[model samples]
Target: MTSTQRPRAFRIPAADQTGAIEGDVAPPSTVRMVEEPFEIVEAADGTPVPVAPKSRAPWLSLLLVALGGLVSLGIGLSLERMISDLFAAAPWLGRVALVLLGLAAVALAAIVVRELAGIWRERRIELLRARAVEAMATRDHTGAQAVVRDLAALYAGRAALAGGTKRLDTLGDAILDVDDRLAIAEHELLSPLDRQARNAVATAAKQVSAVTALSPRAIVDVAFVVFSAVRLLRRIATIYGGRPGFLGFLRLARSAFAHLTVTGGMAVGESMLQQALGLGIAARVSAKLGEGVLNGLMTARFGLAAMAVCRPLPFIREPAPRITDVAGELLKGSGAEKPAP
Candidate 1:
C-alpha cells in the first residue's frame, strides 16, 4: 500500500480526547501536570497552550549590525584622514603608518575569519544532531551510528582545541564521554530496539490491513498501539536510569502530545493519497492507517527523548549489560518484544 494509505496513529487528538490519549502517552496516571509560570493562551482548537520564553533575536541582531556598521564607517573615515595628513607632513612617517594600518587590517580580518569559522562549526554540529535524531525516528541504526561517530569526532576536535585550561579540558572530556557512551548505546540499545520496532510495526500493519473504515476495533487497536508504544518508551527510559517519576512521566506526556500534530499531518496526506489512488477506499480507512503509522513513529521518538531527558550515565562498556539488558530485560515478564532467536 502507498505510504499515504497508512494510518495516522501518531496524530494528537482534539482537546477533549486529550485526557484519554494522555494516559496512553505516559504512565503513572496519578501524575498531575505542573504548570509553567508564564503566559497561557488558547490554541486554534481551543486548547490552552503555554507561551514559551521570548527570544531577544531581533534586538540583538539590530544592535550588532548597527554597532558593526558604525565602527566600520568610523574606521574608514579616520584612516583616510590620518593617511592624507601623514602623507602631506612626512613621507617616511606616512609609509610607516600605511604599514601599521595594513597589519591592523590583517589582524581584524583574521579575527573575523575565526568568528565565522566558529559559527560554521556550531551549525555543522547542530546539523549532525538533527541527522542523528531523524535517523533514530526512522529507525535507521546504521545512519544513527554514523552520525554519532561524526559527533564524537567533532567532540574530539573540540577537545584538542581545548588545550591546557582545566575547565575547558573538563568540559571537553564530559562531551567526549557522552558521545562515546552514545556510540555504545547505538549498538547496545538502539540496534535491538529497532529490530523490535520493525516487528511491532509489521504486526500492527497486518492487523489493520483488513480495515475498510474506522470501526470500534480500529479505534481500540489504535489506542492499544499507542499505549504499547508509550509503555515501551517508559521501559526503555527506565533501563537507562530514566524511570519516569511523577515529574518525569509528566514530561513524557507533554512530549508525546506532539504526536497529535504528527498524526494530523498524516491524515491530511492520507486524504490526498485516497483521491490520487482512485481505489474508492473509504476516507476513514486511509485516516486510520495514517494515525497508526504516525503514532508508532512518535512512540519511537518519545523513547529517544525520554532517554535524553533522563540523562542517564553513559554505558562505556560494549556488550556489557547496562542498567538493564535487551527489551525483554527492560520489560521484565510483561511479554513485550520476545527474546531474539
Candidate 2:
C-alpha cells in the first residue's frame, strides 16, 4: 500500500486544456460575415380538411344551454316561493304580487324580443356590408345594385336618412357602375352619419383624456378608460343606426378589439418614429402630461378602430380619421400644448 501511494498522477495546466494535438495549426482568422435573411414565397398550400368543422365540441354548447336553463329554473323557483309565501300570508298581498310578477314578466319578454331583433338586424347589416365590399372589389354591377336595395331597405324608415334612402330607391338600377353606386351610398348616406360618428368619437376621446389625466388613482384611470371605450363603441354603433344589444355589443367589441390588436403595433412604432424623427412630443411635456397624452392617443386609436368595426360600410369616400388627427385635436382641447414654443 505504501509503495503504490508513492506514484503520482500527471496533471495538465488549466490554460493548455484544449484538445489540440501537437501538430495542429492555429485556426484561420475569423471572418465577420453577415447573412441577410430572405423569405421564400411558399407555393405549397396546406391540406384542406375534408370533414365538417368540429373545432368546438358539442358538449360545450350543451353545457351553455344547461347553464342557462339552470339559472332560469333557479330564478323561477325563488319567485314562486316568494309569491306562494305572500299568498299564504294574505289574499290581497298575493293578488298584488301576481299583478307585479305578470308586469315584470311581460317587460322582460319584451326586452328579450327587442334584444333578439337587434342582434338579427346587426347580423343583417354586417352581411350586407360584406357583400357590398365584395361587390365593389369585383366590380359586380348587378350585385352592387342588390346591395344598394338592401341598404336602402335597412335605412328605410329613418327620417334622417329619408332623402338618401329615397335617392337610392329612385336611382335603383339606373347606376350600373359598381363604383358609382357604392360611392353614392357612401357619400350621400354614410357621410352625414360619418360626421356625427366622428363627433361622438372625438367627444369620447376628449373625455377619456381629461379623466385619465386628472384622476389621482390608477384604478380610476383604468375604470374610466374601459367605461369610455365601451360607451364610445355603443355610441358609434348608435350613430350608424345599430341597436346593439348586450350580445350584439359583445360582437361589436370583438371586431373593435380585433382592429385595435392589429393596429397596436403601428401605434407603438408611430410613437417611436416620432421620437426618432426629432418630433418628441412626449419629451416636450412633463411625465404625467406625456402619459396623459399617450393615453389620449390610445383612446383615440381605439375610437378609430371602433369606427371601422361599427360602420357597416367600408371607408370608401370619407377616409378613416388618423390617430395624429385625433391626437392633435385632443392636445389642443386639453391645453396640453408646448408652452410658447
Candidate 3:
C-alpha cells in the first residue's frame, strides 16, 4: 500500500474544463421566503369623505298635526251640541248619557295614560334586556342576573296593570318565568352554552314585551264598553220618557219612516226595472231559473250573516248565526257530496 500510493481517486476537472459547482447554487441575496405586512391603501386624493345624515320632512309632520287638531276640534264641538240637544229633550236620558260619557272619557283617559306608561316602561325593559344580553355576551353572569331581575320586576308590575283580558299579562308572566330560568342557569348550572341560551331568552322577552305593549286589547275593551253603555242609555230613553219625550220619539219615528219610504221606493223601482229587463231572459232560462233564484237568496242570506257577525253595517246580532246556518245549508246543496252521518 505504501508503494507509489496513487493520488486519491478524485473527480477533478479536465484540463479543458473550468471549475464550477455541480448543481445550482443560490446567491446569499436571493430570497428563499417572503412575508408581507398587511396594509390598507388610501385614496391618492388624501381627502376624508363625509357621510350624509338622515333627515325627516318636518313640514309633512306639521301638516298632519294641524289636520288632526282641526278634526278633533270639529268633533268636540259636534259632540257637545249633540249632547246638549239630547239633554234638552229628556233630562233623565240626558243624565244617563252624561254618566256614560263621563265613564267613557275616564276610560279613554286611563287607556291613554296606561299606554304612555307602558311605552315608557317597555323602553326601560328593552334597555335592561340589552344590558342583560351584553353582560351575558361578556360572560358577566352577575351583571346579567341583575339586569334580568330588574326586567322581571318591571314586567311583573306591567302584568298586574294590563289586567286579565289582555294577553299582555300572560306574556309578562312568561318573560318573568324566562328570567327565573336564566337566573338559575347563571347561578346553579354555569356554562358557556347556558349564557348563550340566556341571551336568546332575553331577546325573546324583548320582542314579546314590545308586541304586548302595543296590543289594542285595551282600546277594544274600552270601545265595547262605550258602545254597550250607549245601547243601554238608548233603551232607557225608550222606556222612560221625560216630559214630552213622547213627542221626541214621534218625531224620530216620523223621520225614520220618511227615510225608509224614500229608500224603499227607490229600491222597489230598481228591482222592478231589473225584473222587467231580465223577464225575457228569465223565460229563456226558465229551466235554471229556480237554481239562480235559490243562489241569489243564499247570497243575500250570507251577506246578512257576514254583516251581523262583522257588525260592519249596524245590524241586530241575534239573527247572525241563524242566517249563517241558512247560508251554510244553501252552500251544501243536495247535489253536493253528502257527509258521513
Per candidate, the number of residue pairs that clash is 21, 0, 0
lDDT tens digits by residue: candidate 1, 196-231 = 433443333333332312445666766665566566
Report lDDT (Cα) of residue 273, candidate 2.
57
**What range of 10 consecutive residues in model 2 has the weakest lDDT sum?**
34-43
Q: Model 2 Cα RMSD, Å? A: 15.3
Write down the TM-score for model 1: 0.31
What is the lDDT of every predicted structure here? Answer: 0.48, 0.75, 0.40
Encode model 3's per-residue lDDT on 1-341: one tens digit a residue: 47876667767667445335557454557433323212332334644344445577899889999999999999889878878888899888778878988998999888776555544543453365466556645766566446545534443433332332233324333434434435543332222222332233233323222333333565643443334323322232222111113333333334334543544422345443443333333334442332332333323332222222211112111222232232222223322433234
True lDDT of residue 40, candidate 3: 30
Candidate 3 TM-score, true structure as reference: 0.30
Candidate 1: residue 18 lDDT (0-100):
72
Question: Top model by TM-score, which number?
Answer: 2
TM-score of each: 0.31, 0.76, 0.30
